[model samples]
Target: MNLYRIAKWVVSIIFYPLFRIHVIGKANVPKSGPVIICSNHISNFDPPVVGITSPRSIYFMAKGELFENPLLGKLLTSIQAFPVKRGMRDRNALRKGLQILKAGHTLGLFPEGTRSKTGELRKPLAGAGFFALRSNAAIVPCAIIGSYKPFRRLKVVYGEPIPMETIRESKTSPQDTANIIMEEIQKLLDLHK
Candidate 1:
């Protein structure tokens, strides 16, 4: 098995037992084709939670800092994570994201850009929507609740795929699309509560 699969199995085994993980709307994730998984950033645990919960392998645009450590960076890269410099245009990273989507892979993105220390959702950065619109990939808004604490029951809710056609027809700007994605995530949060 590949590193991604190995990591997924190991993480699934370790994490699920540590915390009660409840995954909802698994059917909402497309079985094939490119997809954008836009999730709320709660904690570092959020990535593994979402990654293992999904049925398919998901690639992530992780912060550049994580790639600074030689060994850890290699491990992360083996699991399909690329680095992105936060708080800048980071054109190279964006191009790599677009390439991933165009190649029909699921690209995971924390639209909020950084972890929310308070566990509350924040405004999304434009990159998520820009990639979604540019790559014409379906957007899946995922809300992860209560995973910030160890041994707490964690809930991951995946909302229905927002079609690329809908986004295109809306004629909204990239920033607006990002806002809409965040809004869907907020709705999922409300529903779960």
Candidate 2:
């Protein structure tokens, strides 16, 4: 097996016992085709938490600083995570994101751009809109409620897919499109609360 799948297996084994994992609306995930997963970021551990349970391997875009160390960089890449500068508009990240979708793979983006310190859903970033329009990929809205809770039964919910058709029909601006995506994710989290 390739390193990516190998690393996923190893990490999934490790995460299985660490958290009380639960998935909602997972069936909405398409079995194939391009997909973009938009989610709220509550903690640094959120990526790996969702990664282990994801229906397919998801390429994650992370902050550039997280890859400073050589060994850690290799490890992150093994898990299909690459670095992107947070500020100053990261073209590299955008380009890589489009490529993933073009190749018919899944890509996960934390629309808030940073962790939500207050555990509330912040407005999503514009990059989400850019990718959705450029790649014409189906967007999956996901929410991880209770991620900020300490030692509690954590819930990670995946909402239904929001097809590009819906966005286009609504005549949404690219930025507003990102907002709509996050709103759906928020609704799911609110449903469980």
Best by TM-score: 1
Error of 1 at 124 (Å): 0.9
Put down candidate 1 lDDT per residue, 1-193, tens digits, no spaces: 9999999999999898788888999999999999999999988888888999987789998889999999999999999999999989999999999999899999999999999988788888999889877887889999998844667888999999976686777877888889989999999999996
**TM-score for each candidate, following the candidate numbering:** 0.96, 0.91
Candidate 2, residues 1-193, lDDT tens digits: the string is 9887777788767655556566777788788999888888999888887777678789999889989999999888887998999876888888998999999999998888889998898877888888887886788988887753444667778878886786786777878988888888888878987
Error of 1 at 186 (Å): 0.3
Model 2 poorest 10 in a row by lDDT: 145-154
What TM-score does prediction 1 earn? 0.96
